[model samples]
Target chain A: MKLATPRRLILPGLAVAVIAGLLSLLAYPFPDALEDSLESHRPETKAAEEAGPRPSSEGSEGWSAPLPDYSVPGVKSEGLGGALAGILGATGTFLALLLLLHVLKGRGRRGPNG
Target chain B: MHIPDGILAPHVWVPLAATGAGAVAVSARAARKRLAEESVPLVGLMGAFVFALQMVNFPIAAGVSDHVVGAGLLAVTFGPGIAVLCMAAVVTIQALVFGDGGIAALGANVVNMAVLSTLTAWAVHQALRPAFPNLAVAVSTVLGVLVGAGGAAAWVMLSQPYGAKFLGAMMVTHLVSGLVEAAVTLAVVKALRASGLVPGDARVVAR
Candidate 1:
């Protein structure tokens, strides 16, 4: 099982990252299946509806999301914000995984290929 | 599905959080020992791919959409241990940075998507791959979603007695979404193998 050299893998990886980031801009705005299923189970009483939104749990109230719902803060255009967030998120995840794997590398017995 | 905060009771969330953290620790050890030097970049890129793919939710029904969970994809490409670590990273980022899943319920979400989903998918793949390579990838992915969703439903039921009634509905919805997951996983895996990024003998490489 010959491994694809890092050089060979880079182009495809970048293509996927970019394509996925761009495609994320077209993400449907509808609630996901879990959200919809959970919503259906909630009581639809008049008073409950009138109560507005329920409060978030304790210890998490003070926290603020830098890019809430994958939107950039103060970004006027939804499409632009989402796109930027998507790119940023993909980059961040890629970097984070690299750092983690690096730190974990050589901790135990080396793999056969290694 | 990412479980939001406040839904899970303290008792439920606390123990689960500990378990999630412990599982991640063990998986990290396994990954350190088993992961290959040349595979690091591929693993990171795949993690990014999964994270990005998750952002694109496809609407499946009235008021309902779903995204690629990608645990099965990672499981087939790398292995269960590394897949779990990658997914844990993705889920943690979603909760802390994106606020997609609740901070409090992070443990539950991780356990469902990262641990249970990846392991179940890996198990299914290993069990069926020899006899049905293509079929294994698709079926394992669908089953992964089903198991993950079932775990979520179970957590809800344990935390709140009334939540039990929604299990059937949750499974039904996830079954539809699972097919979508299966299709995406199958397509992506086939492409990876064709490109030689993932070898024909993926299992041998993964180990």
Candidate 2:
């Protein structure tokens, strides 16, 4: 089989895109895994958390660490999920477009073969 | 740099999406103008080849695995417009089917990896083509890979929260990946050229 045929190429591309999209959707709901993976080596955050609170001097304001707030609006953990969805969606669109364009061009080039 | 959702604020993603859409549109139009029926299959095949190449991940420092982001390679093999189209397709597939990048950040990813890298590589090819006509293929391949990886690193630094370590990590990982991609691209181009699959004229292949 020739590697350059549109019919042969589209199926695999579509299959991959669909599988990736589904996986992303499944991964979206879980946030903790992503955060933990991305932040496993935050030395600064670890150091700050470990050190005791420091008192402020008379002239200088006292050092106070902000409270940990996870309530920021629209913030969600779905890192892997989002990436998967975006890639699949875009890939599907691209493959479909390529197939359509190829068919159209093929038709224009040859009456029956196209 | 497949940035997942929640990494970037919505404001950043939205604008990047718009920019990416515009760039893709322009590239499609350009491709339509230059492409012939015979070239279509080659472009599509190259896209698949890129997808396959991306799957072969090489080990970066520690246990992290990085793969080829073939924006530069595509541009060198095809033209910038076709390369952009091909990469956009690859990235889309990677994001949707593989969960490699976030859906919301698709636009940013395309812009950074596809548009920026292809255009940069093309520009470098144009500049160096005159001086090193014989080495155009190798030079273009190297430039494309380096610029594409560099563009991704830059985008990650700018879009995400500021931190030198983060940027440094991205750059280091991608730089190694880029070199590997460059070597692969050079080998492919050389083989194609030697086999008579690619014509002597660079512009002809690009068209």
Give the number of the best model, judged by lDDT: 1
Local distance difference test, candidate 1: 0.83
User: What tens digits encode model 1's per-residue C-alpha lDDT throughout B63-142?
Assistant: 68888889899888888889999999999988888888888788999999999999999999999999999999999999
C-alpha lDDT (0 to 100) for residue B140 of candidate 2: 59
TM-scores for every predicted model: 0.92, 0.67
- Model 1 TM-score on a 0 to 1 scale: 0.92
Model 2 bad stretches (over 4 Å): A1-100, A103-114, B133-146, B149-160
TM-score of chain B of each: 0.97, 0.89
Q: Looking at every candidate separately, what fraction of the true A–B Cα contacts under 8 Å does it contain?
A: 0.63, 0.05
Q: Mark the 10 consecutive residues where model 1 chain A has the least summed lDDT.
A: A50-59
**i-RMS of candidate 2:** 12.7
Q: DockQ, in order, for the candidates? A: 0.55, 0.06
> Model-by-model lDDT, in order?
0.83, 0.58
- Once fitted onto the true fold, the runs of candidate 1 whose alpha carbons sit more than 4 angstroms away are A43-59, A109-114, B163-165
Per-residue lDDT of B1-207 in model 2, one digit per residue for the tens? Answer: 555554555567788889999998778766765666555666765675566555445555455666666776677767787788878877776665555566776787788778877787778767777787546655655555555555544554454443566546555556666666667777776755664544545457555
